[model samples]
Target: MKADPRGVLTGTHFLDGDHACCEGALAAGARFAAGYPITPSTEVVERFASRVPKVGGTFIQMEDELAASITLQGAVWGGAKAFTVTSGPGFSLMMEHIGYAAMTETPCVFVDVQRGGPSTGLPTLPAQADMMQARWGSHGDYEIIALCPNSPQECFDLTIQAFNFSEEFRVPVMFMMDEVVGHMTEKVIIPPADQIEVVPRRHTRKAVEDYLPYGTNGDGVPEMAHAGEGYKFHVTGLTHDEHGYPNMTPATQDKLVRRLQNKIHDAIDRITLLEEECFDSEDVVVVSYGITSRVAQRAIEMARERGLKVGKLRLITCWPFPEKRIRELAATTKAFVVPELNLGQMVREVERAANGKARTFAVPHAGGSVHRPEDILKVIVEASR
Candidate 1:
């Protein structure tokens, strides 16, 4: 389905990552948003709240992060493409609801503009520390789609994809942006609504009495029923039967839990999105994401100048981590230099995937700022050797 032209700001404009994300959400048909404003990411909801009225949508400033997190789910069930935006502290508060969104199979989106922290650390600085939390912060066994946008341009582009993935998989998709990217300003090209292709909501066609909210078709994603539409579908945060009623049996638990994990695990090949450059003959590869990817490019160039054959693997989709591609590259590459704005979260995944097929090194940064190109180049040069 093409976007509604009314919501699309179809032209080029100089915009920050946060504003670009807001524009992207508007373009993707997000007509409702609920969020407790927080730093770096506040601009996202700020723009949304200001623009939603113009685009025929609603924006609610909930009391707190928890309310904002779950309220978006209510909006989704009410048949709106809805989401919330947050940063470090608020992201922490939203974890429980993230679990709830996963358990109930609620189709929603979470825009987390990351900052340095365990607790209110560096609210204004950039960091990618939440990468692991996006995958495992929510308790229990469940899977979600997470994307990292590297620039204001990608911030615009990937925000649409995040909504599309959430709708397609019937799960909350995380748009993991960082403070730098969220605040950085760049030229963003928003094409006409007709030029953009969007995935329409998979609304169930069955009658109210025939609907089975937990029942999935061949693709493992159950069709969603509109709330208050006479479908009378049930949604719960517990293990549920096909009818969406709580089912306490261990067997029921296994069935529901496994499906949640398998739906994403099975689609890893199709869901994993990454960009590789100069990998054909490079001996060392720098794997990074979000704002860090841009910083890594400088390191890649520096390594090249020093006679190091370096390539780059930028993770466009962070979760459903590109294990296969990493494993495949491990076989041919001499090593991988992972530079992250955190203390080596994703680098561990790289090491595991490499499985000693090739060595892996980390150029860890303790958040407040990004890595210096020469710092990453040092690691790249070491890995090259």
Candidate 2:
């Protein structure tokens, strides 16, 4: 709980969500950030811009989200860990480049501090409406790691995890944050520098002339060598072979795409992170993520006190949805309830994972409001009976 010499807290301190996220990215070893100012997410960039420079990092505010995303990609290729922060509208603008980053297997974090709806619907309000979009926002069949955090402290912790996942899988990771959590001020415990496990991108110790940019070993992750490191390499959106050069042949393209997808899917059991509280004895399970999970947790406790068998699964990684865990719960639990600030986006995933073994229901709320624990408890009580 003591403050580090740097004045960052090792335990809990009252801090805004934006500052927590910035600190998390820094702690995760991010060396560059490029972003354009957008509501509900601007503070994240602002905080990073101020802090990054102090740590010998680079922060640039680009003209728009497209440029911001592209700039981060360039920074990553320049041998620095990089990221960008934006909201709904800006995320839409960044889609094309996001697809590019995915196709090229770039390791970077994109923080989406979610606001409401299509085209800036509720700029300052909380909404998990982008849950589905985070999975398929960019075109094509590439894999991505997306994490959602329910509290300010988690906003710090999971941002680090997001970067680690991105680097490990060689994919773009999304940090999904709702306005409620992004703007709220709460107690956050920043761990000591040594206590935090920082995962840097894998680089080769092989001789410069022997390096192949996309050459994979047994686990399918290639050692990445940046440009200007005296390592000749090619990077592009087009399907490329192990050397990173474009391969237009259908067979080669197929191999490239499949590897990109499978590397992530095969690691799903390992990459999927979730927290289950009181999962074993429950007849009904409340599935939620981000801030909604907090509500669901309270609801489960109240339902249990009322002699109802209820538990909660807090999704830490939203993308590559926790199918294995959900399947296990489906076989044992009687019903599953999902609550989100948006309507039915994540509940669909829950139902798919449940596979008809348990009834899946959604409690959706939007327009600056959050689902209350009493409302979630009511559903749990009904399911328990």
Candidate 3:
């Protein structure tokens, strides 16, 4: 076992998904954070608040979710990797800032431990209802990355991946978790600091006079200059020019928005991550993510036991929606069975991607609890037939 350093507890230990996520952020060099307290998601920042100071960082419990969301972006511009955690209604409160983060190309992470919700739906219970919200809750035409982790270990692993993706693309990355996964305890092994890979911020190498806060050298992502390093740069949410100044013209909006979306769209192949178990003759494919993926796996096994040919596709990266892969699979697969904790969220994506080439079956759950394996298996059996 490697010795623990600064914030890395470098060994195996039992941890809930929230704690593991905090450790992942620390390991990924998140030196600052700001968040408001909310159930199922509060422990992530509670641990962060306790751990960050020892590592020469800061964690501020902001007045509300909106303040917490924007404060982290301030920390990011000040040259620190940062994040915020929230659940349900709190997640809804942060939408405007999420759009701001996208407009300004802020590199930060938002850890949303989802719970049942229309308004204060189920604070302590599980739900995958936030899937579509993570992608489109924020008003705007910009793009962001979102990841779903089904276990404690993945909660640790994918949070680091989330931070890395944010820095790499200079966009906000959503770390989506459900209450069940967030509170589920399991063994999570933390690697030594030296062994962990952290993506450093893409600071500008140009002289102060030569740097433009939003100026890019061809690849849509711009080099960032710290807030107080004698770099005169502007940051705003309006349609902006390369200099980060408000332009507010149709031409500017078209150019800016398309670049924001295209930077991600062009790189979708590299960004999408999935775990698959498939056979050439499998007729039904179970498409799922987050904690529901685990439930779907059990259902898939039961279907196979009945001599049914079934495959599993677990989404580790949910946003940007693996359209090409689903389209390709639809050509050969007989049907797709999408089971989610929400009444029907990601199944719509499956139906869209399948494009009628394959029949689509949805197994919807209304948030308080996960679907029974039999429920999912029944859908699989129906889809197969």
Best by lDDT: 3
Residue-level lDDT tens digits of model 3 in 1-385: 2212676778998999999999999888888999998998989999999999999999999999999999999999999999999998999999999999999999999999999998999999999999899999988797899999999999998998999999989999999999999999999998877777777888999999999887888888999998779987789998999888999999999999999998899889989999999879579999999999999999998999999999999999899899898998899899999999999999999999999999999999998989999999988988888
- RMSDs, each prediction? 0.9, 2.4, 1.8
How does each model score on TM-score?
0.98, 0.95, 0.98
Error of 2 at 369 (Å): 1.5
Measured by TM-score, how close is model 1 to the native structure? Answer: 0.98
Alpha-carbon error at 129 in model 2, in Å? 0.8
For candidate 1, list the clashing residue pairs, or say none. none
Arranged by TM-score with the best first, the candidates are 1, 3, 2
**Better-scoring candidate (TM-score), 2 or 3:** 3
Please give the CA lDDT of all the candidate structures: 0.91, 0.86, 0.92
Colliding pairs, model 2: 11-189
Model 3 TM-score on a 0 to 1 scale: 0.98
Q: How many collisions between residues are there in candidate 2?
A: 1
| Order of candidate numbers by lDDT, starting with the best | 3, 1, 2
* Per-residue lDDT over 94-171 for candidate 1, one digit per residue giving the tens place of the 0 to 100 score: 999999999998888999999999889998999999999999998999999999999999999999999998988888
Alpha carbon lDDT of residue 97, candidate 3?
A: 97
Give stretches of model 1 more than 4 Å off: none
**Lowest summed-lDDT stretch of 10 residues in model 3?**
1-10
